[model samples]
Target: MESKRVLITGAAGFLGSHLCDLFIKKGYEVVGMDNLITGDLSNIAHLFKLKNFEFYNHDVSKFVHISGKLDYILHFASPASPIDYLKIPIQTLKVGSLGIHNLLGLAKSKNARILIASTSEVYGDPSVNPQPESYWGNVNPVGPRGVYDEAKRFQEAITMAYHTFHGLETRIVRIFNTYGPRMRLNDGRVLPAFIGQALRGEDLTIFGDGSQTRSFCYVEDLIEGIYKLLLSDYAFPVNIGNPDEITIGQFAEEIIELTGTDQKVVYKDLPQDDPKQRRPDILKAKELLNWEPKITRAEGLKLTYEYFKSLTKEQLEKIDHKDFSEFTR
Candidate 1:
């Protein structure tokens, strides 16, 4: 029998690369795609030699063409971090808009199940603590973070449209903060930024008073949730993340202790529209997907620190102190 095939966009990225690994391990013919804009090839370099794994250096915002039968498509091609989306807002908007359009059409044509990576950012600076999937969100479409936020919001809308009007098989996972190996040290997210600063013997930078709250779900547990959601007969968005929330000030202190670096926490002006509180109400995910994070923050942090510490000195030197703005998932 022929193996199933999956097309994972942004496969060179941290999460996308891990998804590629999962599908390949399941004996699927994995077709990975990325334009290498913010994604690093090294993340998926180990899979290049596998017969079941192939890749295309292409952007989903443009035309996407794949040969042969495709059973699944995981759309994860957008610029995720604030540093990335802020730098290339146009491209960021394009992927969440044009990119998902192409993938959805392709999924329809191929009769493939499609899963999109929506985000907690969709609930922009959420008013309610522990945001649920039903919240309409409080977003500033013209704000600096709007490019990424609105794009994801639109992605979810269009995805639901396809599922309703066209009878497409669709799954949406609103990912919360996730940290692990393969994360770019300078991606500008709070976790890596704090770790990078600590590793460099520099003060950990926190925008605002460091009182804003965030919940982190380790990458491995996140991947399991995604995998289960893909196979489940669900069509609505599900929140997948750890709900053990912590304040930024508290998290910075935790990082300092974990890294064993003599760096103190420093504060700066928070960027406009940065959420003061962000956490997910994941009851839906638990009831629907039967999933919750298995890794504790302490265990996950130790593993993540070891990965960052194992980086070559050259890799470590590439990290420079900058604004450590937190993008909650």
Candidate 2:
């Protein structure tokens, strides 16, 4: 059988790089594209030596032009981190709206199936407990995080439009909080925040009593779920995340244990519009993809700690003091 040609946007990112690695291992020809906006090339630098892997330093928001018979296009572009999207708010919106449009066009031209990396943020400060796909989100349009949340919402709308109007093969996966090795330490997300602080012997900052709950999916599990969705016949959006829930304070404690740090926990003002509770109802993923996260939080956190510990002193410092101001538009 001929090898499938796969194109992945944001190919150098935490999740994107992992997807690229998986595709290459599956005997597929992989093409990766990124602008180095929030994604670091170092994440996938090793893949350049692979015969079936290719990298392109291009931003998808402008225009995407690719050759060869493309079988699949995974649009995982856009700045996902709070610190990132806040810094490049315009780019975040552009990538979700225009970038997705461009990729859908390419998918139509190449007759390739397209999968978009949407987010659980679509359920902005969600009122639902375990959010189901049927729940219409309650997002703030003019809030600080609106740029990213609304962009993802718009991306999903446009994807479905292309699927129905143009008859293009499209898949949307609403990814929840995902963490693993290669995640940018300065991304301002909770997992890295806790881990970085603990590693550096800094006080772990908890916002709003650290009562907010979240479900974290390991990168490997997330990648597998995405792969299954792309190949599956389901058209509607499916949630892909570990249903295991943890409070922010508990998560901080876990990091402290892993890092063996004696640093104390510090309470800080919660960011505006922070969700009180966020977890996915993965019944669809379980029934359709026959997938559940195999790696428990303990196991996943240990693996992540090993990766973070391997970084140089300078790299460790970079993760210690991350600036989140840039994440806003």
Candidate 3:
């Protein structure tokens, strides 16, 4: 009777950290890795005391070397947010390509199943309404968001190669917008951004008239989907997200209501290549993994708002005001 071991890259990130919790709770010996470029150690700090948990302060894009058997490799490392990828586009690209290369190699060496976290961004400005896994996507390769988008595309390409050529077991999950407790209030994603502004008693800024739409999945539901996918026999991609759709303007109102903040909505110009709509067609996930998001927006939002409220005064004040410049290459 031996415990399973899992290597979770970006284990300090909001999503990655949550995976660590889920795996550990399910009786797995977890090895967490992160460069902390955009991850905060505090997210995974509590797990440090667990006997079965360990962490590596290394960036996977550069090199990844882990000792002992690795039963699973969850490649969750990357600067996932626009602000993060914009500031460190090169790093994002490298992690998605080189970092994934390293992990695939590790998985092959250990004969372990690997799951790489892809994004809905792959279905860039998607021509299809609720993007099915079959949609090829409508992406501008040189656009501002292409760094993250293309990197993920490359990651998926190479991952499938290993599965096809090298015969390594693999999984890919196109994650939609996920929000929860450990979310950085300044990650520049709509959820945290709205929460931060409302917490600080500032007007919620809506870019591009807030007409653009996004679908949000609760973190717990997303983690469950990932977990089921890993153990399943599927090798292709699966969309893991809540299909409930809402516009930025409408979502802003929801946040204001949940937080009891009197803040009004303000508008700003939309950034280049921003998706007008994003909702996952999870029919494949539902059929294959028997998964669909269970957390309603109201329940999830209230929980997330309380988490934001529990932040320290200084953390609450740490607003990200860095002006982002697009990556042209």
Better of 1 and 2 by lDDT: 1
Candidate 2 or 3, higher lDDT?
3
Every candidate's lDDT: 0.91, 0.89, 0.91
Model 1 over residues 53-125: C-alpha lDDT tens digits? 9999998998899988999999999889888888788888999999999999999999999999999999999
Q: Summing lDDT over every window of 10 consecutive residues in candidate 1, give the lowest-scoring window.
A: 320-329
Model 2 Cα lDDT, one tens digit per residue, 1-329? 88999999999888999999999888999999998777777789899998899899998988899988999999999889887777778888999899999999999999999999999999999888899999999999899899999999999999999999999999999999999998877578999888877766789888899899999988999999999999999889999999899999998888888888789999989898888989999999999989788999999999988999899998766544445354434
**Candidate 1, which segments miss by more than 4 Å at Cα?**
317-329
* Residue-wise C-alpha lDDT for candidate 3, range 1-329, written one tens digit per residue: 99999999999998999999999999999999998887778889899999999999998977688999989999999989988898888989999999999999999999999999999999999888899999999998899899999999999999999999999999999999999988877777999999888877899999898889999999999999999999999999999999999999999999898988799898999999999999999999999999999999999998988887877787655434433343223
TM-score of every prediction relative to native: 0.96, 0.96, 0.96
Q: List the residue pairs that clash in candidate 2.
A: 85-327, 86-326, 86-327, 86-328, 87-326, 87-327
Candidate 3 has an lDDT of 0.91
Estimate the overall C-alpha local distance difference test score of candidate 1: 0.91
